[model samples]
Target: MSAHVFLHLCHEVGTSLEVGTRRDIMDIINTLANQMRTNLMMTSGSRREGFRLVESDLDVMYWPNSYRVIWELYQSHYYNNLSKELILCDGSESRPGFTLLYLLSPRLYSELQRACVRMKNRHYISSSKHRQIKCSAESQRSTLHGPCVGRHHGMLGYDLAHCFASDIWPPSASSWIDRSHSWPPSHIVDDIVKRGCHFVAIGHKLEKHEQNEWRISFSLAEQKLVYAMNHFQFLTYGLLKLILNRIINNGLGDDDKLLCSYHMKTAVFWAIQQNIIPQWCPHNLLYSSLTCFKLILKWVYEGICPNFFIPSNNMFLSNIYGEAQNFLFIRLYELYKMGIQSMLETLSITSCNECIDFIRDPSISSCADEDVLFSEADFDIKLFREVDNQGSFSVSNVQKCIQFLHIIEQMIASPLTQNQDIMLQKLTNSVLQNLAFMLPLNTYTQENKLKYRADKISCHFLKFAAKFGCISDVLYLAMYYYKTFRYTEALAIIEVIKVKLSQPYVMHNFNVDEEMYTEAVGGQSWSTKMGQAVAWNIKLNNNILYISELRPEQQSSLQNDVPYLYIPPFVMLYMLEIFAANM
Candidate 1:
């Protein structure tokens, strides 16, 4: 194909995330990260680098300080029991959150017989569901199969990950490949070293312990590369992901898990390492993307996709076999020949839907009353000198809180009207009063800060959307602003709502729920059905009914002893009510 045609196709596939959508994603991530500080951590891919297309996942990591604490407990009782196995804490009885990893030597695995004896004595009485004992051998080699997980709206899901910190790399260097002064800018390098690298245990086995190895991951390094990319280079990576997901992967069927977007990423990394930057100019975006595809094909043919930092560690070594590799190579070749036409056909519907949704979501628009936002808002609030600390919050109380939130959500979601102002005021006052009453029930982490005053954080976020007026969600945006003391930003969102009436605000996507199903059944039809049933039951029981914990398997990997990060529902509703009243 000629250069013009390729670049045109690149433009079509290289759609970047919209400004508002990007901000919303970041804000959601920040809120979650802050709330779950003791359990989960957050990061981004295409969303952060600005070259995101229709197909991208918001990847994050889950690691509580408790994981480290539990590991230390086992470490303290180290001994050469003929079984050589270290009793990593059992996570079987925990809630669905994150997995507990156990590092075992060959000698230990044999003696432990896939079972750990309960420790005889302990200094402290344990409250965590995980036991102080050895674990059975995992049914699958991949950590994702065993314990690696994330939760969304009470459902469990999977996202890409590696270790948080590694022992092999230079502690000071920014990027993983610190030697010889390679491609990424100096600033990028500095960031990598500061953030550090993680290790992924590959080829974990029950019978052959010697086969296991630690693969050094340069995920942080790759993110730096994407961020540092010129506009054209960003397009190149987006096109590559499109090709992998639509062409090669679709050909392998939905059940196929081999050759993910990460493999394509490593191929691009390898090309850059070989000094292919000159060929990766803006005009040659499609050409560069094609070149990376060829690199992937070469690796697939040889049954080896090298880790960018640690070349000896092959990423595709276990994920694919000869038949699968050959099949993928052939499919990718077919896609290369089809070229721009194939991408246009494959991405048309998905891209169009994304654009349509981006325009629909209101969190992107400002709700300022005039052209500018106000410096201060005047909402009636009765500050209490003493809190109403009550009995232990029961399931019924939580159900009531959820009911109130749902009611407010429906009211805000309805179309705007002239008389709605008085109703909003009353609703806000009522919510605040109830929230004040519930405040004492929440066990505050710190008594000094007003931020710690509310137990359920989401309550402070109750938003009201008005036609050509400031929205309730904007009020939520205001709450975060108020907490950070950015009153101007908060007022700006509030003011915009007063100016122009617009379409009803779209609900935030609970995309993670779908991911939870995918992880539960590993994407098989029969098991997927089973997983759906299990998920529905869990959601009904844990969320709608407020009567249960996660499923045993789901709970096995994710639950922890760390106090729950989220504020109780009552506190969240109260805060949202107050926010709406002031707006």
Candidate 2:
């Protein structure tokens, strides 16, 4: 496990696609994506960004753009009143910034459903149900021997991401609401916005519920970040992902979906943000990787993994359980201690599964003997459930809220089905009972403003339930509050939730340690301003100097260490100082 050997291995495994083959693959993927799009009338595009020669396989983002298409169909139903089944509830009127549409008519509903199925079949090439083309032995041959037809090189090897590309800014961006603070460069933000962020279709028990919401993905930004990395940084990331996907995840068990490449990507992002860039040299690659492992382990230990762009969006909100979280933390911590020596051992024992053939020969290989198509659908689709996790209300209340949500969803969609009246009545009755069970008793006097506020909040909740068919938003908002250390505000929001849903929440109370949070975040003026915005929705006053704009004298005042729960201390200081020195 000498430096020479490790470096050589890194070079061997982490090489990018050869010039010709890279071009060919891109052409094939784009052509196939376009064909599917033209034939299906849906948006489809593929980008090869995260692929590493022998280390990683063809990592493509198969964007289905389902929400946009469905949204158009929904608009048609709303304007035409095509069927009684397609009921549209304008949440914008009742609630300021939301909209929900119900699929009521079973016949028309079936049509939309059929369209969705078609989209799934045409774009969602991984699903067993949609693999009707595989029924014939002749069709299977195309997957086997053909130069352009192997799954790995062919169009079929891609992981389909049935996501929606939307122009909406992430809710976490609200932290930068105050004009006084300097945020990520305006140009960068503008570029991200122009490219448009995507939201993947993800939820728990999504099939049974009508409202399957989207989870924001900065994959486009992620690709950019990867590209921006130096050679060592790129190689380090590829190596870490290899360890996580092969050694650690395999050790956990085959069915364990707890850890994945995205988690590793998140760790890398955080590391870069923390000024670990300089540390990611060939000489220190192992150390930098250890830092990444430590960061992820810390997240696992705390049972919270912050989304790099969205501070409030916890990536591990739904996946990590009590036993699982503990096990993963211990395992990762051990790996970090073992360092490169352990990595060398793992690499030696583990099969070299990287796409070496695709890189060296530039020839498409087939997996004809394979019984199953390995896809990321399972991990890619589960959106983090919004739950008031910071001990605001009882977990049972939260669970009840989620249950009531399904009832409300069914109630709303019932009218669109054949048994409209009967189903609606039954669902309505069931919803009322659940609501009664969940909502607080009317105790305030008429003179009390609390009573009126409660009524208003209740109205908003009911309307929202009708729209989205769930109270997950309430949970997510509460979590956001908790993450920002606004415990009181978080509890206040939770109290307004008129449902008894139960789930795991942060047991510990958040202390508004302003200094700690600011230091951890880095960029003094921006950090202070962001804190102010979170505490009180103040206008973003342009009063502070970002690290990039800081003078030598100002650098002395930069918070070098922060105690924020999300990112480690000193990271902010490192980032600020590094930027200042470079500038």
* lDDT (10s digit) by residue, model 1, range 458-564: 33423321111112223333444444444566556645533321222111111123343344433333212221212100011111211122234234333432111
Candidate 1 displacement at residue 540 in angstroms: 17
C-alpha TM-scores of all predictions: 0.49, 0.43
Q: Which ten residues in a row have the lowest lDDT in candidate 2?
A: 382-391
Which digits, one per residue and each the tens of the lDDT, describe model 2 over residues 280-372? 555576677777887888899999887667665576766685887888788877877776555655664223433333223435443321112
* RMSD for each of the candidates: 17.1, 26.7
Q: lDDT per prediction? A: 0.41, 0.41
Clashes of each: 36, 30
- Stretches of candidate 1 off by over 4 Å are 1-36, 44-54, 66-147, 154-164, 167-182, 200-207, 210-216, 254-257, 277-279, 337-469, 473-583
Give me candidate 1's TM-score against the actual structure: 0.49
